[model samples]
Target: MIRSFAVAAIMAAIMAAIAAPVAAGPIEDAIAGSWRKPADKARDQYRHPAQTLKFLGVKPGQTVVEVSPGGGWYTEILAPAMKGNGKYVAGLANPLASVNAAKSVENFKTKYADKAIYGDIGIGTFGKGVADIVEPGSADVVLTFRNVHNWHMSGWDQEAFNAFFKALKPGGTLGVVEHRLPEGRPDADMKKSGYMKVSYVKMLAEKAGFKLAGSSEVNANPKDTKDYADGVWTLPPTFAKGDVDRAKFAAIGESDRMTLKFVKPK
Candidate 1:
């Protein structure tokens, strides 16, 4: 009877081992998954989605909000990463407010329709002093990518920062990735250049009640002189100059960007 019990225990252990789920691979696997478009995948070398997300402390099962997904560049990766286990809120510009914004919303819906990987994403409208789009104090993480310059230009940076502050839980995080201007560049110069001063961004967030958590150089490109003729748009992707020095800019890759992480103090 003792020998029989030992054999049964061994069998149970083998079955348990077989039933266990496989350990997950690195986050890069999710970014490189088959669901991504080839063009979007190509940009990963510069964007560093895996490293960036890791820095933001994004984990499965957290509630994340992305402000102004704008063609869903990050959405392409975020939607899938959050599928099944987490929540993703997309705070968009009100479509009725702008023809371009209307098109952006339509494109986003069309692209993800019937695609289970996107899961059930929440949609909200933000901008122009309007903050009702996202539920206040409900988000675990709020992220914006290269978008602060637009708000700065529109004279709504403070309002937008305040909205972000309201949207996050007390302990939640705000992650920003924006084109970085050289230190001491005046705010007036930033209006048209699409590059923002790091100090200025931190000031705006601090003014809205957030504390600077940390900053990362993961996305920095020292090759960018921050003095492009057409500003950051002169870099690869946009190449605003249109082949004026395509090879030169392409060699430099994307603009140097600041990756900042801020938190709503608990």
Candidate 2:
């Protein structure tokens, strides 16, 4: 039987649609999964998880260590993405440093105990004077998200970088996402404010013998002028000021960030 010409065309179009493959792969699928907390998913607009990870050369089957996963923001994504294929290790905080640090390590384990969701996430230590977050030269990638400022504040940012370098295999990658302070800002602000200059971050990596491979603006936010009284926390999420110019800060969204990729020398 001969069908109408328009009906044939419509059927052809339907076939084409069914055959076309989805461009987003496992990384994107993991980010969209329902297992992640709603609050964490909402921050994707500012975090740009998939894009940043892609730019950093993350792939399945490679060991990746997430340094000092404060509250596991990236953990939700990294753990699931690496499940069954790669190693996902959390470089835990230094309990010897403070009482809270000890509790943080314990809380992270409990929070991510559901293997059905997080997989087998190994644990290790990362802090001042103690940086072996994994077996030396074991990880293929070492990712630190917005935690550099904390080490800088604690006067051990270099130690953290040295540890990252030690953990990664030769030729491995180190992906860093951090709130950015403008270069014009005084160096002292890096300690007090929750931000670091891109140059300063690069210097730390270089000093640790890692070469800067590339950088991405995937997480950049121009709305952040980087002069908030409460630092990056003045924006949404933290709102450190607590209702002071709340609407204004909300409009600004998250802080501007610099995403960098460095490589440990072979």
Candidate 3:
């Protein structure tokens, strides 16, 4: 009877192990960091920082360049994750590009100057025929989050992709997370709405000499009806419509995002 009880206890322990949540790794640790604002933490439900980084293949010791890191949301996680072993380069428009772009980069640097939290982050440049964001073939990973639409609006989408392609090492990764337009939508909608077509984005990258590697729905939202009055800004974070249908947008959450990976041939 004692042996029978012992066997049952062992089986129970094994089952418990299987049921346990995944142990926090470096990326997870960075996402759970105390330095991140509560507001930023709340977005993790939609952002899925840990899973997104894993999909992008961001690893320690890699030279990671984040293009147009608006508000430094990912910077908060990446800086700490890369503090000791790697570099975090923030690629924004060069200070000479425009007043707003210059101020934005300045504000970002001032906001993230804390070495204890953000490490020694570097600055790189793109846009406005400003040239490379980093040295040719220097970066292991180049990530752009939801900023592609702005480039499209600027009519420099091709230039931006060319810059990204130039910045990456051969066999390196270019990870893009952008608001997605449905396949059936008119291509012109991309210019009006903030969302873009996967095919169009792929064409841009391919024009810049990148081969598609993979794509993920980790940030997909089926509830986004994609016909908002103010485009994607009509959603929760922007709530462009003010109180009108705020609850409806809140329930819908963030826009559906396409998480794509492209590779520079070795």
Candidate 2 residue-wise lDDT, 94-124, digit = tens: 7788999999988999999999878899898
TM-score of 3: 0.91
Please report how far candidate 1 places residue 235 from its true position, in Å: 0.3
The lDDT for every candidate, in the order shown, is 0.88, 0.90, 0.91
lDDT by residue for model 1 (113-206), tens: 6457787887888878687658899889999999999999989998998999999999999999999998878667889899999999999999
Cα lDDT for residue 209, candidate 1: 98
Candidate 1 regions with alpha-carbon error over 4 angstroms: 1-27
Best by lDDT: 3
What TM-score would each prediction reach against the true structure?
Answer: 0.88, 0.91, 0.91
By summed lDDT, the worst window of 10 consecutive residues in model 3 runs over: 125-134
Per residue, candidate 3 scores C-alpha lDDT tens digits across 190-266 of 99899999999999999999999999999999999999869999997889999998898999999999999999999
| lDDT measured at residue 172 in model 2 versus the true structure, 0 to 100 | 98
**Model 1 steric clash pairs:** none
Q: Rank the candidates by lDDT, best first.
A: 3, 2, 1
